[model samples]
Target: MVLRSSFFVASILLLTACGSGGSKNDSLPSETPEEKGESLYVLNCASCHGEDGKLGSSGAKDLSVSKLSDQQIEQIIRKGKNAMPAQEAVLETDENIKLVIEHVKTLKNKP
Candidate 1:
């Protein structure tokens, strides 16, 4: 009976160990602001906007030459425009939207 009890306890401990592995994000190293923003943009915006934000696929704007203010960009991201779809649901939070905006700014062409 003691042997059976020990085996049961060992099985439970093993299961607990496997179950406590945590989420995928928990295993990743913390990202810098630029890294985080660029990652978010790549995941959510790269398809239409391109890596340098100049692909302009499907009527997407060329962000490299965009002159819109930050507030306007935020509005367009949250609400979308023309062929673009609203991103509030896709981005999931205002903080994420801001991150994408920061990355977009980095894509602007220097004079």
Candidate 2:
């Protein structure tokens, strides 16, 4: 009887503790253009571009030194460069592509 009672008490405590932390989607949304751009960059770019966006991987060019303009980036995403496949279908949304381009600008020379 004592063991069963202890188990019940523990279960109640565990459940109560879990419920106090709020639902899984309790976080606030990004409020600024830069913040949104960063979020999009992380989700779509960090894998190959790395956190700094300069780490060349699998023959991908270092974005920091690339002379590509925002328009070129958009074009590349829409139609793809040699190695990269066209992301028109994948990054179908213009907002996401624009945000990525904006974030990529931050990868300039680290001086």
Candidate 3:
């Protein structure tokens, strides 16, 4: 009876630990501005926005040399517009959002 009880407790503990969402996968990728922006952009924006961020999908506007200021770009990213999905939640941090705007600024116009 004691052995059976011990085994049951061990099984319960193992199950609880295994079921816990303790994996590092969901944790933030980077803390620094550049790293944070690069990581977020790569994961969320690369598909339609392109790796360079200027080659938008068909109707999407080119971000390079955009007339918008960084604040405007950041706001648009956070709030989204038209077909674009709001990213305030996905970008997570304000600093990181700013970082993304800064990175986007580097996407200079093509010659």
Candidate 4:
């Protein structure tokens, strides 16, 4: 009886350790385009541009006060501005560039 009880407890513990009761979807929720854009921006742009887009390090412009249109911004991002490197290689896709543009727009200072 003692050995049987120990075996049952061990089995239960093993199953619990294996995440038996966890949700079927163990993966984290997919990031929204905005979230992904912010992440990409942080990885690629935040060092000079800052988290709020106002740091302006290494001659990086204050993005919070930027007035460039989306098309202009897209051009700069794809081609390379004065001090900024061309991001076509870094961003890889137009979709990613658009997402980053959307995130950058959110950094504008409120009136």
Q: Against the true structure, what is every candidate's RMSD?
A: 9.4, 8.8, 10.6, 6.9
Worst 10 residues of 4 by lDDT: 20-29
Tens-digit lDDT string for candidate 4 (50-98): 9999999999999999999999999988998989999999998889999
lDDT string, candidate 1, 34-93, tens digits: 898899999988899898898899999999999999999999999999999999899998
Per-residue lDDT tens digits of candidate 3, residues 1-111?
999999999999998887665755667654677776777788887777887876788456777657898778887899988988889998888877887887777765543
The residue-level lDDT of candidate 2 at 96 comes to: 75
Full-model lDDT, candidate 3:
0.78
Q: How far is candidate 2 from the true structure (C-alpha RMSD, Å)?
A: 8.8
- Where does the lowest 10-residue lDDT sum fall in candidate 1? 19-28
Q: Number of backbone collisions per candidate, in order?
A: 0, 0, 0, 0
Cα error of candidate 2 at position 19, Å:
26
Instruction: Note the Cα lDDT for every prediction shown.
Output: 0.89, 0.77, 0.78, 0.90
Instruction: Give the top-scoring candidate (lDDT).
Output: 4
